[model samples]
Target: MDDIKAMSFETAMKELEAVVGKLEKGDVPLEESIGLYERGAALRAHCDDKLRAAEEKVAKIALGPDGQPSGLTPVDGL
Candidate 1:
């Protein structure tokens, strides 16, 4: 859990992908598979939390005037 708390979204996502691949391969022992599934779920939850935080920040943004500075585009395919 501590490790997950410290992981960036991208890192967690990569680990989650690996976990999914292992589970899909169907070669892991049942007990190990269960553990992997739990880890994957945790990673997923962490990623979701990070995304929600990002969404909240994005929502608070306001576009500047045409002559003013322009930044912060829509998060496409989020």
Candidate 2:
């Protein structure tokens, strides 16, 4: 299994999609399905965090007096 913490947002999202597909098919054994569900949940949370962080960074960009983007602030812990 890959380290969820180290996985890129795109990678996590793709894996989560795959997990949903398998669960939707309803052909997986109960135990395996549970594992997949857990992993999917983690992936979902990670993706959400990544997206939220990105949104924050975008929002933090310095705007000029004319309301145009001037520059970006360094996002902490991103």
Candidate 3:
């Protein structure tokens, strides 16, 4: 099995999309479909985690005009 940890977010997401496309095509045998589904689940989880980490990084606030760094604040009505 490939180590998802060593893969970049783009790679993982691309692989997941490919797997989903294959499954949607309905040409794979049942056994192959099951295997692909399992792999897709792992890749999806990895992609989700990477996205969350990215969102956290994006949400980080730099020092404001006061020159003191501030934590992230939620957007209104989120």
What tens-digit string does per-residue lDDT give for candidate 2 at 4-63?
Answer: 989899999999999999999999999999999999999999999899878998877998
Candidate 3's residue-wise lDDT over 3-71, tens digit each?
987889999989999999999999999999999999999999898989987877666656678878776
Please provide, for model 1 over 1-78, each residue's C-alpha lDDT reduced to its tens digit, 9 standing for 90 to 100. Answer: 789999999999999999999999999999999999999999999999999988876765667876454665555554
Worst ten-residue run, lDDT, model 1?
A: 67-76
Candidate 3 versus the native: TM-score? 0.76
Q: Which parts of model 1 are misplaced by more than 4 Å?
A: 67-78
Candidate 2 residue runs with Cα over 4 Å from true position? 72-78
Assess the local accuracy of residue 53 in candidate 3 as a C-alpha lDDT between 0 and 100: 78
List clashing residue pairs in candidate 3.
none
Candidate 3 deviant stretches above 4 angstroms: 66-78
TM-score against truth, every candidate: 0.82, 0.83, 0.76
